[model samples]
Target: MIKQTIAATAIATASAAVSAAPLTLEVFNPGEAAIFPVASVLVKGQQDAVLIDAQFSRGEAQKLVQQIKASGKRLTTVYVSHGDPDFYFGLDVIKAAFPDAKIIATPGTIAAMEKKAAAKVAYWGPILKQHAPQSIVMPQALQGDTIKLEGESLKIEGLTGATPDRTFVWIPAIKAVAGGVVLFNGLHVWTADTQTVESRKQWLSTLDRIAALKPATVVPGHFAPGVAMTPDSIAYTADYLRKFETAISQSADSAALIAAMKTAYPAAGLESALAISAKVAKGEMKW
Candidate 1:
């Protein structure tokens, strides 16, 4: 159930980025920026469509819009998933094409965007004025834990195990789960320099949350569309944290821990975890 996301997944891969019917998801790839957990598209009939995540750049965002138009879906709304700029910033370009679509994000995401917007207005204001056009609407409908939209009910809740903003959406009708950031498979478990110390233990328990759903298809936040949610996605990331933490706590140095881990999993994000390891070595990383 765990697919290899090597160069085999086709780097810089572009597959029209569109769906054929009831719904098809695609990988905007985004090249070096961030891979995996592309975008999630839901097409219900011709007049109803919803997208989760706009991807990183203006180009991918345009393609996503085209994909929706190609499906003849009326591009109703987009769920930001979280406030990571790579995930949400492209909403600016997206709105130019689909002017009426609204974004659905948690309170955290909304506040983050507003703060960023304010920062752009105050300090980076010139950059915002020159290149970043702010047109996408602020997220609404805190919707707390769940939201019923267009016959599709999305339950939004954070899994303490992943990042604090981690969210998962459950579609009971299809037995499908869109675990935004909580569970990631075949890609770096983290990209945004998350607070991973204590999140490690919580990450393990979060798997229990996804497992409780017993989903058939799991939609990861970064890469492609996924099925086989359970241990395939959750367990892998948890295992990494567990092993890394154990080794570090045992006074393993950064080089030793990274070498052992890299040998075990060629794709282990050792480069990504270097800063983390240094912190652990210095006792700077909290448990």
Candidate 2:
């Protein structure tokens, strides 16, 4: 009787382990319509969900809130992957909707957000107008590199690298990546921020690190509509950066650089990004 009881307990434990649900991901982006096509991913477990980055405009964040409500999962945390305004400017809406959600980000990211949030708002306010956030909701500094959803771990990578502020999330259970500023897809890769050659090189290295992980799902922070969220985006971004570098060295002015990139990526969207990035790269405009 004792032997039979032990066998039953072991079998039950194995069954429970096999039946445990995996975390699922849902991504929301405003596509090319709203300024930047920033992606916000909702990582849902059995009972809880975690949001990665908030959208740029208040209206878009409201849309994201509707999606979360539709998911029927309680949101526990909202993790801002980068310090860019487009990533967290809509946090005000998110906070209002899920007031209990713990908004968090890497310490470096938090610092950057704090430093630039006001200036960014001043610059973009006129353009966004009605869709602009009435106020900013700052995220608390994340204590560690890991965020837990259910029993699974969402690891924040690239913290110790050259660009600690620019990090991505690695969800091991799902073998997925939520790439931040380091990755772009179906759009002209933003180079205005990483104007220095070394900075661009570090960005490339970050992409390679992500590629090494071989994630089944890869979500680019900024991508055009209909672009597949896959490893192919990584390749597209890296190649664009290389081409931009070549164009910068060959061209004498921002116009030439812009022409070169447009020729290289005729189908890519976000010409505004390419124009500004080319100007910054050619030293014709300060970003």
Candidate 3:
């Protein structure tokens, strides 16, 4: 039994000028259960904007499209943070709303997206029903690590977490990092695709690298609705991963691991990730 809160909370705020195209990030948190809270951000310039990571499900995507349109900013591009279904599945709605908006991703991300298309459709379609994307919308291969958006350079970098080739957008001007699956603020960290201890360690290293950049703000892949992504959010995530690693070593079995984890972090919302990770650890599940 998966319980959820699919509520959308909108946040409109401005940041200091990074360049002539000072960005105002408007985040929409669709508090959906089973599916974690997805942060769909509209990075608005003075006259245009770039969307980062489409939300999951058709209804969620449609709502996001409406919000972007309502902002009156000409959407120029949509950059998905990773290959995960939650990140890119709503591209259909985005394309429908902003036909001229170019969708872009890293070369590795593009390849991963192509590989996972079938599995995603099969797994998500039944659950999401009409809300799931009717077909895959692939992003164009990013020519270089950086893209110029309204005179500001948005740097695209790969950081592995939920999946390899996970992309993060760094705006040097504003010192803001648009973290994909690599960061989770006030949300359950997804571990279904992380299959090994080495991989988890690498993910931690990736997080550390992002932290070193010392962004004034970080927009995580999943976050509490309307709440700002702060440095504390990064700390919270780092602590959770450490605890999860320790719990894996101390627990006797999957059930014990989950029970202990629940007891240790009763307030954490996404229990599904715990269950899936535990099963994967015990060789009882496959990602």
Candidate 2: tens digits of C-alpha lDDT, residues 1-287: 00011111121111001112488888786653455657788899999999999988888888889889988999999999888888898899999999999999988898988898889889889988998889988889898789999989999999999888899999989788989787888778888889899999999899999999998888888776556777898899999999999999999999999999999998777777888888888888887
* Pairs of residues clashing in candidate 2: none
Cα lDDT of model 1 by residue, 178-231, tens digit = 666565655544522344566566666776777787876665554422223333
Q: Candidate 2, after superposition: displacement of residue 90 in Å?
A: 0.8
Model 1 stretches with alpha carbons more than 4 Å out: 1-46, 116-137, 159-164, 191-196, 224-231, 251-253, 268-287
Per-candidate TM-score against the hidden true structure:
0.73, 0.91, 0.88
Model 1 TM-score is 0.73
lDDT of all the models against the reference? Answer: 0.55, 0.82, 0.74
- Tell me each candidate's RMSD, in Å, in order: 5.4, 12.6, 3.7
| Highest lDDT model number | 2
Backbone clashes, each candidate: 9, 0, 2
Ranking by lDDT: 2, 3, 1
When sorted by TM-score, best at the front, the candidate numbers are 2, 3, 1
Model 1 is weakest, by summed lDDT over 10 consecutive residues, at 1-10
For residues 144-174, write the lDDT of model 3, one tens digit per residue.
Answer: 6777778988888653344448767888878
